[model samples]
Target: MSKKNNKIYLDFAATTPVDREVLKVMMPYFSEKFGNASSTHSFGQEAIAAVDKARETIAQCFNCDFSEIIFTGSATEANNLAILGIVKNVQKFHIISTKIEHESVLEPLKELEKSGHEITYLTVDKTGLIKIADLEKAIKDNTILISVIYANNEIGTIQPIKEIGKLLEKINKKRKEGGLSKIYLHTDAVQAINYLECRPDWLKIDLLTFSGHKIYGPKGIGGLYIRKNSPLSPIIFGGGQEFGLRSGTENVASIVGLAKAVESAFNNKVKNFKKVSDLRNQMLADIIKHSGESAKLNGSPKSCLPNILSIRFSGLSNETLIVALDRAGVAVSAGAACSSRALAVSHVLIAIGLTPKQVKESIRISLGKDITAREIKMATEIINKTIQNLL
Candidate 1:
């Protein structure tokens, strides 16, 4: 890989560089304001106050009460806590999720299934969207939870989250009318925060998960929003912290950084979307024009995230393309960074109806907030050249 400053990074889906402004706000928390949030002294009180303010800022973004936010070490941890924690309290029940969920969500569901919890993995259409009817059909008398990804990390297809949420809300209402239990909705909103509306109440979601690193903030910090009165058992046991849901010493710096990142993202969302999406479109057009009939878009052009472009070139190896792009100083990925190391084709591609050959030919190009038109043009030129050589 090229040196950090030299490479044109188009892999924002994997992670993002922390913004300088966010870093500035986090500096004090690391040293000068360094105090255990649980301490009773003045230093501790100051740290705790900062942590509280951060929580409140994040809550405001999600349109939820401050008490509902529980900070965790990462989005993966938050996901595990939400899935395992919820299923722990229910002895026997059915859970519904889609096949394209992040590994964090899928692995936990597998564990639940092993323990005899019935799980229904919904299928997605060609556009990488789940049908509401399929979801409705999956629910049963013992249904406890329905978890879905807000926006797919690999393909960047935004699901019909609001529709699913509303469906669940109506179902819960019917269950209430019949004096039965209500089903809860959970969304892993990690990839959606930068480009989608994520207010929990508006989406009618009982649980939501997001992380900092994807939004130009420090890593090792993320949070889960639990609706009031939602039943959950603690996944980690230790000194009571985060309402006893996540127990550990608060990561003061990253927490503060997350708040600043959220504030920046929400404030400039409209402007950033316009700029990044235009660049993505231009890049896609050039890439398609250069690659000709051999190239095809992988996800729905109309319904996908603004900054992501997943495409496949017929008979081309994505692994070779990724390595060539990397050597050419243009960074991209074959799939989710978490699973990129595996030799197997992406589960998401297979789930969306791609054959094994098409899966091997696919690559993901995710845009960052700071990417420029010049950079996109140059990257596309490099990609075109690489594809030509590979072909």
Candidate 2:
């Protein structure tokens, strides 16, 4: 057994600890190479070169043209820019999204709805998988966009983006007869990039958004990949930074860190995924073995990400489990940290058809590269004991 520590972090889905090497790369940008990338002097030239190198690395990770990547403040900003930027240019716009999308997607759609845009939230199955047929039927002439998450953050369900791409290709072909408006496909790929195989060119996504923090990079920096010549209006207007798409001075240090983190993560994606997934599987097996009939898996068993595991307890509440685990020196979450404070049931859980009781009883346990098999074993033991005592 490993030495017992009071803090076992398994909340990687919410965010990750920055890699030491990434931090090392970002250090000089903050103090030594500190120059506004927009400046014309030699100092600025170095900063600009660094940012350009980062941008190219990001593009290579997505296998897209370097010019297509636009750095933004965060994935939330990227999602907003992608959705609002596209919809603003069209009249009577319509969008198709899953009911279980991250609030970043749902809230923007809500704001758009309040602004008078029509939206149809496609329902998901019990496993949290959205139906492609539903998506197909929802595509109307006014459907300006379809924004689906590549993989869910809460439940770790991988959506059928490639299948949807094929469906859209067929629909786009037929819709050309009536001069139908071209439907743009966008995916919030923040959670899917490190954990899944995402080929934007093959998937035919018009826009893809990802954040650096989610993939073990610095927070507050992300990028959106817009297919060449995709019609998108600028949400923020200022000096022509990021092709005048995002107007700001740019967080040079964070951007540099994000780029390095994304590059390194993608480079080691396959090996990292296998390592994390093995730890997660061990934890899941232990949870079931210890908790027996009371413990159950919440997300898609087969088609989900290797890192995230949302477990449901039949009798105990999430709060109890989290508190008990924390006291025992294990850290987990009931859901997204953004919504962790609310005592209400998660919208993702509700969308997946879990009862109010089941939702309150559920807690999300996500793993990262830092998590070891020993840590997983300790966490599961704490969780089991917590549930037993709560009952």
Candidate 3:
């Protein structure tokens, strides 16, 4: 968690504040440069230029061509487009995905199932990682797509994306020679764009989805990287914007913000990772030192996001702890923010082998680049004190 004004907010996995540089680039688009990109006038030309430049900027950061970047409303929409769009007209085909994918990816796959498509949900280990053997074995002759999350939003478990990509590359080459359908790899990189390797070529992903707000950019704008010739049909239909993949008046301001944010995140990724990781590690040490056997870390300690920590405090309800922390001006989360209001235990925790009771005892604490040593110390003290009071 990082201190913002008077509040300690530890929910970076949910969203991040727009960076000042991003805001500076975006300010003109809202009004001064306000123009429908579809218009043929000079105003529209300016707007389209901004959109093109933003697209090119993002493409460079991801090591993709300008034509590969498709802007969408959100990562959810981008993810839906990747999953549902790929098999738009094709049906009864097999798709492989992980059990721990975000609702955006999972729900679209479920929709495909209703339309006679076969889906194989791969299970993860206790540490929330998919095995390459299990994944390769799941590939049937008819499998056309494999969608997995690069990193979990709640538990912070980083998947073996690069390895999976290489595995798919080999399998895909064989499939191509055998005249089998080439399996497309798609990763929901919403949690990884700010911290991890995001190059499409290196990841060998056919499609990639990410959001702006998750990377200190504005909301309502995100991008999809569709590798050249990867079969994907448009989900949203209209004036053929975004190479006909998504059609709408582009959110010009947010698109500009997204570009700047991506640039900043890539440029500062290493430095910020070093700093936040140290703070996160130290915070874990402090909390464990104070709470002894009461505090246990969830998720993979080694193969996880540097800034996120999922902790289970035995005999404590995560909901109660979140509310108590909210009262104390420290904002945390039980799981994914989109599904937090639901009464059901987190599907993520359940998939990772947590019992229903243990799920209730776990909370997600994801840090941002701005988190401080002082804030970490204060948050640990407050969390331990609060746990003691509840006990």
Instruction: Report the lDDT tens digits of candidate 2 across residue range 1-391.
Output: 2223557787889988788889999999988999999999999999989989988988888898988999999999999999999987787888999898888889999999998889999999988999898899888888989999998998999999999988898888888887997888999999988877666888888999999899889999988999998888889999979988999987889998998888887888889889988888888988799888998899799889999999898888789778887887778899987898777679999999899899998989888876777778767777777777887
Task: Give the better candidate number (1 or 2) by lDDT.
Answer: 1
Quality of model 3 by C-alpha lDDT: 0.90
lDDT for model 1 comes to 0.91
Provide the lDDT at 93 for model 1.
Answer: 91
Candidate 1, superposed: residue stretches over 4 Å from native = 1-5
Instruction: Candidate 1: give its CA RMSD in angstroms.
Output: 1.4
- Give me candidate 3's TM-score against the actual structure: 0.98
RMSD of each: 1.4, 1.7, 1.1
lDDT of each: 0.91, 0.87, 0.90
Model 1, TM vs. native: 0.98
TM values, all candidates: 0.98, 0.97, 0.98
For model 2, what is the error of residue 266's alpha carbon versus the real structure, in angstroms, after optimal superposition?
1.2
Q: Using alpha carbons, what is the TM-score of model 2? A: 0.97
Candidate 3 C-alpha lDDT tens digits along 1-391: 3565688988898889888889999999988999988889999999999999999999889988999999999999999999989888775699999999999999998988887789999999888999989999999998989999999998889998889899999998998999998899999999998889999999989999999999999988888999999889998899999988899988999999999999999898899888988989998998899889989888899998888999999999999999998888788898898898885688889998989999999999989998888888888788888888987
Superposed by TM-score, candidate 1 places the C-alpha of residue 269 at a distance from the truth, in angstroms, of 1.7
